[model samples]
Target: FEFIHPEFHEIVRRRLQTIIESRIVLPPVEQRLLRRDGSVVDVEVLALPFETEGGVTLQVTARDITQRRIAEAEREALEAALRQSQKLEAVGTLAGGIAHDFNNILSAIVGNTRLLLEDLSEAHPGWRSVKEIRSATHRARDLVKRLMAFSRQQESQRSAIPLAPLITEVQHMLRATIPAGIELTVRVPPDTPTILADATQIHQVLLNLCTNAWQAMPTNTGRIEISVTTLSEEAARAQSGTPLHGASHYVCIEVRDNGAGMSSETLEHIYEPFFTTKQPGEGSGLGLPVVHGIVQTHKGAIAVTSRPGEGTSFFVYLPACEAPPASFESAQRAVMRGTEQHVLYIDDEEPLVFLVQRTLERAGYRCTGEMNTARAIEIVRQAPDSFDLVITDLNMPGMSGLDVARELLMIRRDLPVVITTGYVRAPDVAAARDLGVRDVILKPDTIDELAMIVQKNLTGNR
Candidate 1:
């Protein structure tokens, strides 16, 4: 049998023998036997050799497994891909969730803290401390909000906005924040086409780039320019390397800075989360990632072009908006004032309950506070129609705010309820809204604002 194919037998035997000797074990081999009749039959073999005390003997058997190997390789590749995709999905969800909750907290803190400061008197001894706390909190909150936007968890208001106005707004903010030594310029045409992006996010991107540029410049001289244009979709697709959009219908904004540019290596990972070049507490390194997230969320694309020692330019392209626009104030909603009528509030936070009581009392409304959710429910039970407004905190131990709300509304369908929570995410907003939540207030909301929302609901006017 081994001598059946004299021509190729030596080649096969030598290769098999060498493998067996090197490994000290033989696996299997496939061979083709050619007969004198000029026909070939495929043979497979497995070899095993035994050495007794006096002599040695060997036996071999082989089976064909070409199809099996192919199937196994395909299954392994599919599993690897499935695992990779799951990992990516989990990471994206975690990043987005963190950003969403963080942004909500920041927005509440910054907005209400500003109101608190305004409500405080300058002559008060603690006024300075309060102001400082407000300032710091606002700053930290802004940083967090920016990071969240970059992470893509914060909800966005979709609208068509002219690019020039947005850039001009950003330029104004930069002028106020940037050092006097830095020069800022904006060069977008007044009539640039509309693009779909969140105003707050776009502003942060410009501000971040400008601040980075100013820092990169030597002590006293560098220029920053923001420009916008309507790019053919095809043009944007070509520039981003990945097809960002179809060939002819996108808008792009570019922020160019005449400062020391980043190295290629730095540029490569600039958009990675938590990667920073600044000193401790100076930056969170989420600016670029936030930029990346925002662009991705808006169904847009972002890229940066930089030359070391020269300068850097960042280009962001977003899908052009086709719908008519709403007013900016309407787009950026403000929770409206509540009516000065009967209002009942429940909370576990003593300071918060007291604050809301005082705020509403001063506003000439009949306000009542209850720390025990059970007691509050009893009061509402005795006369659900007696109270015109209900403000309750979620996550109370015994009866959650939603439960209280459901009970109260069950007695009186017309009763208006506002749910306040520090931990509410986008999903919670919908469920709360569905549960007779006329308004959902984020925690850290000012007493005045809280009263205002309640008042608005009672008055049937926002």
Candidate 2:
């Protein structure tokens, strides 16, 4: 019989001849067969030798199985996708746990560092070391934020923001981080529409892409350009293969680098978390994945193109907004010094309780620290009107900060209670606000930020 795939004919013929010579039947085997129409079809073939009046004759049976083969392939693809999702979920859970514990520890260190710096003058020899330590802590906090972002635990604070100013700020920051050999350039048109997004998350996305572009060059020598332009949905899809968005228009932010590019194989797995091509200890492999998560959070899409020596470009498309960008004038905040106002602070971690108590005392607030939630409640119950503000860690044994805050508010309806947590969630914040909690603060905050929150809450300032 003729085969569409002629290459397999000889092999099939050899097997059939052996079966005929042995006068035996062979079990069915799967193979690809060619049809008269020059189309290939999957089939199961069996060969047998039969006695007939015209002497020994070969009989062959073929069963078409194209649909079955296709079904099997689809099943395998689905299984692979499910396995990948499970693996990512496991890693994300672990990352969230690590970030929570690490943030608490960093908060104590950071708060104390601030206090030390306040006592020492700029000329003091230890002052520089302390400042360096503070900077390192800030970097660590940034890593935690990235981890949370990748895990989908971090919440975005969206607002109407102009693309130009944000890019300009990032360019200024990158100047100090990028190698001297790498030139950074930013081009933004004045007419680009504003986008409603989390500025910090968007900043992280740009920083990561630019940093990767810089690192792609072997000698850190390359020109990295970030440009923004407006495009319609159809235009965006045509230019960058970006999906058609619900919005009428999109702002395309392109980060292009004329450095060593990635191969097709490398590009395929670049966005996978923990998948890295760099040398060990050089990267966490979470950068691009984090960027992808951030873009997704902002209801945006990212497309990447690359060739071995032609360099790479990352195209990020964000929905355009017609509303004017919100003004962000920096207003100087007075460092609110605590009066004789009394505060109650509770945390399961005794070290954290001690750290906050000391920090608050130094800021002229009388702080009562408690490691036990039950005791904290008893203290509030014993003298409900004594404390002006109650600050408690959210996650704790027995009773959560939410539970404690509820009980405290019941005793004193006007009590300014602030809930603190390592991880920030929008829903949780909204829920806390509904419960009459004065404010929700993220952990590992600077002493000044913590003080400001406390003062704002106590002074009835939102």
Candidate 3:
């Protein structure tokens, strides 16, 4: 009786008393037992009434069930993780489809607006209105970009990024969104190593983390700290409670908030999709899951810790690289003019094709636009040398952009083939390059960017 766990003492006592009074066997009751060493063990207790020389005696049996319980718990956790993964995959597919269609529409609008702005003088009556329209489209484009990031559909353009500047940029952006009550601080050592990652995605990661931190504060008044440091593989493993594979050193970005923290139960479901503790209108519950996905995609890891009223800290560990930080040069404002180079453009979207045709023509290039892939291929096949460059949309009804590039390149080995897409996968980019593609450009590029690419390819600049 004294050896039983305190919580289960009454249960064991009552079961034995019932068996003694009724002089019959009772159903088994599961409870816990404390060993001599003060360790707890789960046991199934069954009491049996035995007929002895005396009145009635109760015989108790307890089989250890600790291992069984542990196994069941582990299985349940794995099953939950699997379900969450499937849900994310479904959401990603839906988001990618929506982004693709929306980007196509945005491409046409952006292309036409750029052309209009160039043709109209700033003093015109509707110039400001058109400019505002263009600004709205830019915002819409950014929203779609976030959707792509969440869906994991955007091809990451990775380079060596210095954390100091990236965090500073994110700090400035967060200041505008968070309330005045929250105090934000940043501590980054100048010697922090650079990480090979997509700058935009990492930016998004920091933004999401800080946003979550501020919202977790109950009084809307707390200190949020952003810090960067280097960690060895072993130290990272200890901090994250997970092994770090392949990389010896890691760049750790820590976001800490002194706010109303979370319970262990809340932390368990934090990465599950659509699981939010916030009020209905406050959150969609996709932030942490998106952060988890991005970290995994970058070959990195993220760990978090929180306790009720204590605070929360998220540690993002990305493999450190020794490469120098990437440099950014502003794109030239002036559009590169072509010297009457005949260009063949193909896309299923008629409006996009039309806009590209006019835009290219305005930039001193003779352009031919086609909506049918078969006809375009036939034209290229019939007279391969007629067009100096070939630009085709990636996802067409009859054929894909890679196929178009392959067919055209086979016809004219020297012809420059550029593939453009609204949504491109890494595999497709690799396949396109393997097929001798000159370049792959994302859709809805500014007129100057398009002209520059066109000029670069035509001039045979590798």
Top model number, TM-score: 2
RMSD of candidates 1 onward, in order: 10.5, 6.1, 6.4
**Every model's TM-score:** 0.55, 0.75, 0.74
Per-residue alpha-carbon lDDT of model 3 for 43-113, expressed as tens digits? Answer: 99887787899988777788999899999998985776577678878988888777667878988888788
User: For all candidates, what are the clash counts?
Assistant: 18, 1, 0
Tell me the deviation in Å of residue 110 in model 1: 6.2
Number of the candidate with higher TM-score, 2 or 3: 2
- Candidate 3 runs further than 4 Å off: 17-27, 36-39, 158-197, 225-257, 260-330, 446-448
Evaluate all candidate structures by whole-model CA lDDT and list the values in order: 0.70, 0.83, 0.84
Model 1 over residues 1-462: C-alpha lDDT tens digits? 543466667766775576555544565666666656777655566666666675445566656556776788889856755765566567656755554345445544555555566588989787888778766765554454444444444445456767776677677777887888777877777656677667668777777777777877766587888877887778888887667754357877788887889999898889876577777666656678767876887888888888887889988888877765546335224543334578898887665676667667656688899999889988988987788888888767788888888888887888888887644457667877787678776555434255457656777764
- In order of TM-score, best first, we have 2, 3, 1
State which candidate, 2 or 3, has the greater lDDT: 3
Model 2 ranges off by over 4 Å:
4-11, 158-200, 207-223, 227-252, 258-333, 446-448
Ranking by lDDT: 3, 2, 1
